[model samples]
Target: MNNGAVIFAANVDRVARFYEVILTMSPVYVEPGLRVIASDRTELVIHGVPPQVLAPAASGAAPEPREDTAIKPFFVVGSLAKARDMAPLLGGFVFPPEREFTSRRFRACNACDPEGNVVQFRELLVSAI
Candidate 1:
C-alpha cells in the first residue's frame, strides 16, 4: 500500500502552493476546500480546516512556527539545499544546513509550513558511510 498523509489547514491554497514548491507535488484533484497533490512516487492530501476553528497565522510575512504539536509530518526531499532556498519564498522556513542531522542514509532538517505547522525535510546522503 502507498503511504499517504493528510494536512488540514485553514489556508489550503497557500499551503498547497507552498508544498508544491518544496515537495514538487502537483495537484491532481482540486475542489472547494480540498486538494490532492502527488509526485510520481508519493501523494499528499491537504484538507480544509474550518476557518473559525483556527485562524490563519500569517500571509506573506513569516509565521511564528507552531512546533508544539504531537505529530510532525516528514518528507523525503531531493535536496535540502533546494528546500532551504525555496522555503522562505513560500512563507515557510527550513532551518539552515548547519542545523541538520544525519542518520544512516539521510540528512534531515526541521521546518515549518506556511501556516506554522512543524514539518521535516530529508535528503538522501549520496555516500552513506
Candidate 2:
C-alpha cells in the first residue's frame, strides 16, 4: 500500500510551490485545488479548502482540528551525500548527520521545508559481502 501525508493550508499554490521550487519536488497531480508533491517513495499533498470550512484534523472525523507540524516527514535516500546535496536547493541547513540507534549504517538529517515543516532524509550503508 502507498503511504503519504496529506495536509491543508491557507495558500495551496504557495505551499505547492514551496515543495516544488525549494525542495525540488514535483507535483504528481495538480487540479481542482489539490496538489500532490511526490518523490520516489514519498508524497505530501496539500489540499486547499475554504476558510469557513477549515480545520486541522490529524486522524479524526472533525472538519479540522488544531494540529501541530512537529511530526516530521521522513524519506529514505540512497546516500547521505546525495541527501546533503539538497540542503542548498532547499535553502535550509542540514542538522548534522546522525546514525540510527539500531542501525549504524543508516544516517539521517533534518531539513527545514519552505512552509516551516521539518523533513528528514536517511541513507543506508550497504553491508559488506
Candidate 3:
C-alpha cells in the first residue's frame, strides 16, 4: 500500500514557500501554482487555489471555529520537545507537548501564515529510545 498525502490550499505559492523557507525543502517543480516537494520518498504537492474561491479561514471572522473544510497540516519531527521549542521561529504557538500514545510524543500547534492560512503543526517522537 502507498501511504501518500497531498494538501490542497489556497495560494499554493505562498504555502509552498512556507515549507521551502521554514522547513528547508526545495520543490522539484518551480511552477507558478503547482509545486512538488520531496524528502526521501515522501512528497507534498501544493496546487494553486482557483479564482473567486475564498479560503476556509478567510470565510469567517475571528472567535469563530474554523470551517469544516479547514485543513490542519501535521508533520512529524525528530524531537517533539525541540520542535515545540522552535515553534516561535515559525510564528507558531505550541498547544502543549505531551505523550499522546504509548509509543509517541505529540503536540498540536497553530501558525497564522502570511496568506492567512491556519497551519496546524503536530510534532511527534516515535520512540523514546
Candidate 4:
C-alpha cells in the first residue's frame, strides 16, 4: 500500500515553503489552499485550516480542547545531525538524534513544524549496514 499523510496548517503558503526547504524538493502540485509534496516513496498533502476551526467555541461555556489529531510523518535523511540543525532554519525544530536500542539500523529524532505539528527523521547507520 502507498503511504501518505495529510497535515493541517494555519498558513498554507508558509507551511509549504517551510517543508520545501526541509524536503529539498519543490511541490508537485499546488492550489489556492493545498499543496502536495512528494518524495520517491511517499507524498505529503498540506491543507490550510483556519485557527477558528481548531479553536475552542466562541460561547463562554465551551468544552475543553480535545486531543490533537495531527499525524507525524517520518522522513528519511542522509544525516540526522544535519537535518536537526537545519530544522529551525526551515521553521521547524528537531530534538537531538539518538540511536534506538531495539532498532540499531538508524538514528532517529522528533521534529516539529512551525505550526507545532510533529514529524520524524531518521538516518541509516552505515556501520550497522
How badly does each model clash, as a count of residue pairs? 0, 3, 0, 0
> Candidates ranked by TM-score, best first?
1, 4, 2, 3
Q: How far is candidate 4 from the true structure (C-alpha RMSD, Å)?
A: 6.5
Task: Spell out the clash pairs found in candidate 2.
Answer: 55-64, 56-64, 56-65
Error of 3 at 71 (Å): 6.3
Cα TM-score per model: 0.92, 0.58, 0.56, 0.75
Q: In the order shown, what is each candidate's alpha-carbon RMSD?
A: 1.5, 7.8, 5.2, 6.5
The list of candidate 2 runs beyond 4 A from truth reads 8-26, 48-70, 97-105
Worst lDDT run of 10 residues, candidate 4, spans: 56-65
Check candidate 3 and list the clashing pairs.
Answer: none
Q: Write the per-residue lDDT of candidate 1 for residues 1-129, one digit (tens) a residue.
A: 347789898988988898988989899999988998988877888999897987886677887888788998789989999898899899898997799999988999999888888888999888835
Displacement of the residue 101 alpha carbon in candidate 1, Å: 0.9
Choose 2 or 4, whichever is better by TM-score: 4
Q: Tens digit of lDDT per residue, candidate 3, span 37-58?
A: 7666456787777666745333
Q: Where does model 1 exceed 4 Å of error?
A: none
Ranking by lDDT: 1, 4, 2, 3
lDDT of 4 at 111: 69
lDDT of 3: 0.53
